[model samples]
Target: MKLKELAHSRTGDKGNISNVSLIVYHLEDYERLRQAVTAERVKNHFKDIVKGEVIRYELPKMGAMNFVMQEALGGGVTRSLSLDRHGKSLSSYLLEMEISLES
Candidate 1:
């Protein structure tokens, strides 16, 4: 199933960096989400877009995770020639991640 089945996402951008958050709809799925979604996976998912590194921060109590992707904004809003200067499309891509519950 896609991550959208279990969670929703939000995104923010700053100076070539993109911050993405994935919040599980149910607390029970938090663990599964954590296991299936890793920083490495996120980096791979956005391989063509993100150039630097993807760092993931876990918010276990909130059933959420935040991914800090560096060099991902094509140089940020003020300078980004990309259509998604704010990185909102990145949020949608993140939610599209395929999740394996068995993992």
Candidate 2:
């Protein structure tokens, strides 16, 4: 499975970096996402494709997980010219992720 299938992503441009914000719905599904798609997992997924920093943030209150992937757009909005693209389509890329339930 791919990360894109597990959550919704929002892509934005900041200076020369691309920021991807991922939100996971259904807390129960988090287990699947965590097990399959971890911080290092994601980094490896985009290692050759994207060149930047990948940060993961867990939001228990919202029952969602956010990922900030930097430098994924080749260079930035100005250089990558991918700002017009929608990040939602990337959901299919994270379908294999596994998340655990809160105790």
Candidate 3:
């Protein structure tokens, strides 16, 4: 299944970094999301756009995960020439990631 089926996402950007949060709708899905959505996988998923490291902060209590992607904004919003300088669309891209839901 795609991550979108299990979760929704939000994105924020400062300088060249973009922080994307994946929030699950159900508490029961949290553990499964944690197991499948590793930092390495997220980094690989956005490798073309993200030039630096990807750091993930677990928020089990909120049934969510925050991914901090460095060098992802092309540059800071003011300086970047990219169409989506704030990287708002990045969250949508991340949600397109595929994951297996283990029974």
Candidate 4:
């Protein structure tokens, strides 16, 4: 199943950094997402777009994970030439991550 099936995301950018918040729809899904959505996994998932480090912060009470991606906005919103200057596409891109339903 795709990550989208279990979660939704929101993104924001500051300079060259991008922050993505992934929130699980149900409490039961939180553990599964916690196991699958590691900082390394997210970095690998956006390897081509994100040129720097990926840091993840877990919010167990909210059943959410926030990913901080450095050097990810092409350069920065003001300096970037990319169409999605704010990096909105990133959240959608992250949602494409595939995971095993049985896991």
List the lowest-lDDT window of 10 residues for candidate 3.
94-103
Point out the higher-scoring one by TM-score: 1 or 4.
1
True-structure Cα RMSD, model 3:
0.9
For model 2, what is the C-alpha lDDT against the true structure? 0.57
Candidate 4 clash pair list? none
> If scored against the real structure, what TM-score would every candidate get?
0.96, 0.63, 0.97, 0.96
Q: Per-model C-alpha lDDT, please?
A: 0.94, 0.57, 0.96, 0.94
lDDT tens digits, residues 1-103, model 4?
A: 8999999999999999999999999988999899988999999999989999999999999999999999999999999999998999999999999977665
lDDT tens string, model 2, 1-103?
A: 3454556656555654444555666666666555555668777766765576777777655656666777666565456556434333334444444444334
**Clash count of each predicted structure:** 0, 27, 0, 0
- Per-residue lDDT of candidate 1, residues 1-103 (tens digit): 9999999999987789999999999999999889999999999999999999999999999999999999998888899899988888999999998878995
| RMSD to the hidden true structure, all candidates | 0.8, 4.3, 0.9, 0.9
